[model samples]
Target: MASVARQARSAPAPALLSIGQVLAKLSPEFPDLTPSKLRFLEERKLVAPARTASGYRKFSSADMERLRFVLTMQRDHYLPLKVIRGYLEEMDAGRTPELPGGAVAAASMLSAERKLTRDELIREAGASPMLLGDAISSSLIVASDVFGEDSLAVLKSLVELQRSGIEPRHLRGFRAAAERELGLIESALMPVARRKDASSRARAAEMAREIAGQLEIVRSSLIRSALSRLDS
Candidate 1:
């Protein structure tokens, strides 16, 4: 143990990473993270990376951890930047504050995102290969050898719906509905998209997120209203 400690002490520290390197390390899990988004997060004071003598940003390991936490909170819980910033501030002040809405904690954020093989996804989601195949056939899921978290989530939901006698074939209309919504978003974005400038591109992405959030609110309200009628 002492020899191990001595070796550890002799080891070199990790190098500070550039923005591109940070993105390369993180983008697989947070595919939507772009340079502009990182800058936006920095502007919001979610993270404070170091600036080089030449004005380039350099991120330490702690910065990476904070970024992962912020991104995970946004992706999984859909928490807004203000809420997340408040929660983080509490933590920074040496208070172990609970996350609002029971969001996942910091420790879990450090783990790498899972990418499962077809068989692994089936096993993990408790879904049958045939069900997955049917889902692909129905355009509910793309055919892929390796599946990401979104695919796993969909498969898990399908498994529960399957138990209730709902099949992938029955949800085929969902794909079409999604395409229509995409069309609407694209049409709304045409003015910004036509600008062909970096800032406009970033604004377009932010606008797309805002529009999608509003649409989700409308969709969820409709579903809840329909369910209330069914219950009545």
Candidate 2:
């Protein structure tokens, strides 16, 4: 019976990964992850690994890929877990998932081939003309012949703020704060970004975006905590 059980566990299944193996494979990519975190991800239904006869969880190659995708979305996108799960589901179904823009989206918008005129940006962002002008003057939005989706998103946020008695002028400090953060990130990446390979350069860029996303998460959490205190 022991031999039968052993055989059952070892039967030519598609390559199964032990917990240690999984950690070894993924740790470099997600330095902060631990066994508990992997389990937590499983609890959240972000990953479902196969179970061996001995009841040990065995991750398949597909499971590893799914995990990579999930971690990438969270670290790089600063997306809520639920949103990342939805995107993963779409991808699993062979669909091209549209990722959220966060700050990287803002940067991309500035480089888009087509730009929106000031009126067009305001119309798309649902913002007022004065608010757009304020954003421009504050350096939040550059005066460009065209605007990208990032500009539109920023404009939309500005419109929302306006309803809450916050205006573009109130956010003037944001640009200065962002510049400081960017300096820190650039300094941290100096080693990797200095590499000559295209792949390394691309990876450094992704890492920069991921770091920015994490920072955004921290900032948002801090703001929410402060707001809660006010309510109390």
Candidate 3:
């Protein structure tokens, strides 16, 4: 079986894009995208762009699509890079792996995310405008003209919580808890983050994701334990 790199290299040929070209194509959609982020994605094995004799990176069309998928998952779903890498590995092996959140199929990698308008977001989430406004006010969701799937998911959860008589205001502490976790991640990442190289920055990003994944596991376990106690 070919390695992931070999598989990427063996894809149907198209005009390969330089890193700058890749940035040009992707930057409009991902304003925070930088060469370092691209390198970080590559380091995480999420993408395997071809290299020139001078060791410069060149992305094939498939590579570009793969990078887009990885970035989308990270930005929209807040998925860790390792999780994204595993999904891609399965896809490279010709297996249709389920997306982590089951939001969409792996095949959706080739397409752009469906940006939802404010009204559309509320409609899809089966949430009322008041509920959405409350979520924004609670700092659980940001106010924006156009929302992404994440916002829709949050609003949907808010609607369900309302059924349980839980309001967004009741979850305000979640934002502060998230900040605390971020502070922990930043502290853990300081060693790598201090380095001003692309490689180190990439490593720091990957480390942050791994730390966040661990924290999520701990949080979920605590919730389950508390729920079990309540049942008992």
Candidate 4:
């Protein structure tokens, strides 16, 4: 199968854009984007811009679209570079693969997810006001006037867990556990986060998310193993 790099070159190409132009077009939506970050992304092979005879980078409109898709995944899903690259590779090879972080959209290129009001959140999550209050008090979820899609998902899951007699208050330790994991991630990222560039900060953010994803997998696996023991 042809690699994404080769396939990216297979199209009826648009006028090539310079790095500054790419930054200009993208920076409004992604304020922290920088030349160094673009270079970092290219280094990760998440994007493969064409090169000039003198090695100047040239980006096509297709490349821009791909970059937009990639940035969207990273920003919304917090997916790792490797995962994003794999997803791109799968698409390039004509396969419809599941997105990492449980994203169902085949392409979120045009996705601008909504933020819901408190009442809207409760209605959409199928949760009661009291349950949401309890969840907030127990630190299982944050108390926000406006909530994101992820907040709704968490609230809905809490509702299901409540049916199993696991109230939000019973999971108070979860917040502490999450904080402990966060501390570890922050410590590990200190080396990168200490850097004085926006690119380094962006890189650190992605790395933190990648580590968090791995931690979540381990946590879920351990829970499954414990449940299996109960069944046995």
Off by over 4 Å in 1: 1-35, 50-60, 73-110
Per-residue CA lDDT of model 2 for 1-232, tens digit only, reads 9999999998886888988999999898677667776776787689999897989999999999888766766664455566667766887799986765455633543442346887888887887788888999988888888886658878898888889998888888999999999998899899998897655564565567667767888999999999999999
Q: Predictions ranked by TM-score, top down? A: 4, 3, 1, 2
- Span of ten consecutive residues with least summed lDDT in model 2: 105-114
lDDT of 3 by residue, 82-136 (tens): 8988988998999999886464534345466678998899889999999999999
Error of 4 at 214 (Å): 2.2
Q: What does candidate 4 score on TM?
A: 0.81
Q: Pull out the clashing pairs in model 2.
A: 115-146, 115-147, 116-146, 116-147
Model 3 stretches with alpha carbons more than 4 Å out: 1-13, 104-111
Segments in model 2 whose C-alpha atoms lie over 4 Å from true places: 1-115
Error of 2 at 218 (Å): 1.2
What lDDT, from 0 to 1, does candidate 2 have? 0.78
lDDT of 1 by residue, 1-232 (tens): 9999999999998799999999999998888788988888898799999998999999999999899888887776555677788998999999988874462343445465678899999999999999999999999889987987778879999999999999999999999999999999999999999998666786676667667767888999999999999999
Q: What would the TM-scores of all predictions be?
A: 0.73, 0.53, 0.81, 0.81
Q: Whole-model lDDT for model 4 versus the true structure? A: 0.86
Q: What is the Cα-based TM-score of model 2?
A: 0.53
